[model samples]
Target: MALDTAKKSQIIAKFARKSGDTGSTEVQIALLTARISELTEHLKINKKDFSSRLGLLKLVGQRKRLLRYLKATKYDTYAKVVSELGLRDK
Candidate 1:
């Protein structure tokens, strides 16, 4: 149920600042969001997957921290990422 390299690369490419910018906050948040969504879907079908639930919570916390950092350091980029990802309410 983990994300494959191809999917990870796709997220990085879409959210990265440049071609090789994989460690940026935007990219990391995007990757976490993807994993969070995947795990959420997994949980829908497998309610007893406690390990995956923990993982999903961790990813969500990581994403929240990253978004907090981005919002503090670069509001424009943070707004752009949030708008692009459709995560406005959160």
Candidate 2:
């Protein structure tokens, strides 16, 4: 129905950091990624959900921009995230 547990935990851990992570980029990106995945499944059964589709697209764009930022500032972290999220490599 949704992404696997290991991947979900990885994203959740990044988003819910222990300390010194207030308004952190990783947290923001992870949260957006989770939303995107949620909306994806929602749209799967409700294929006629235009509004949800729009929201999903927006989240995907947000995540894409965040990935670009991560790649620019921290390539390794970006790679790890994309791989965990199963996003495209290039």
Candidate 3:
């Protein structure tokens, strides 16, 4: 299930680097993480949902790439984001 607008705004606000920063990388990663988690829960109950599983994998890949980029350019912020989201260290 995709995050609603309200939830999306909340995440954006929480991870935003500055006011009205919806398109920043941190916000993007946070949003993807939220979606990834939601899809994970959905898959847990619907084992036969191959389509959702594929989508979930894609989201994970996207989040991974974004995290890699973040770590490359801003290690401090990357570490903060990863820890805040409870993601595994690389």
Candidate 4:
């Protein structure tokens, strides 16, 4: 269950820093978060979906790395993204 193009576009538009910033850290984290949420729901319905669970773990790892990089390089944008996404303990 992948995100549709329209929803993906919405996330990109919300997190994009510039006009064509699809691959920026914030956009990437948002996209990954969306996918992770979708997979989480799927896992809740299909409890035996181990492959989807593994994929969810991978997506979470990727998002974590991206967030780490953003926090190290741009704290303000990272904070904004975290707040917008409601991520982390903060």
Best-fitting candidate, measured by lDDT? 3
Return the top candidate by TM-score.
Answer: 3
Clashes of each: 0, 0, 0, 0
* Ranking, TM-score, top scorer first: 3, 4, 1, 2
The residue-level lDDT of candidate 4 at 25 comes to 85
Where is model 3 more than 4 Å wrong at Cα? Answer: none
Q: Residue 9 in model 2: shift from native, Å?
A: 9.8
lDDT tens readout by residue for model 3, 1-90 = 979999999999999989999988899999999999999999999999999999999999999999999999999999999999999996
Report the C-alpha lDDT of model 2 over 1-90, residue by residue, as the tens digit. Answer: 355778766666766547556456677777677778778888888999998888788888888888888899988877877786677877
For model 2, the run of ten residues with the poorest summed lDDT? 14-23
Residue lDDT tens for model 4, 1-90: 889999999999888888889999889999999999899999999999999999999999999999999999999999999999988743
Q: What are the models' TM-scores?
A: 0.93, 0.73, 0.96, 0.95
- Superposing all C-alpha atoms, what RMSD in Å does each candidate have to the true structure? 1.1, 4.2, 0.7, 1.0
lDDT of 3 at 35: 96
Which 10-residue window of candidate 1 scores lowest in summed lDDT? 81-90
Q: Which residue pairs does candidate 1 place in steric collision?
A: none
Q: Score each candidate by Cα lDDT.
A: 0.90, 0.75, 0.94, 0.91
TM-score of candidate 3 on Cα atoms, chains taken together: 0.96
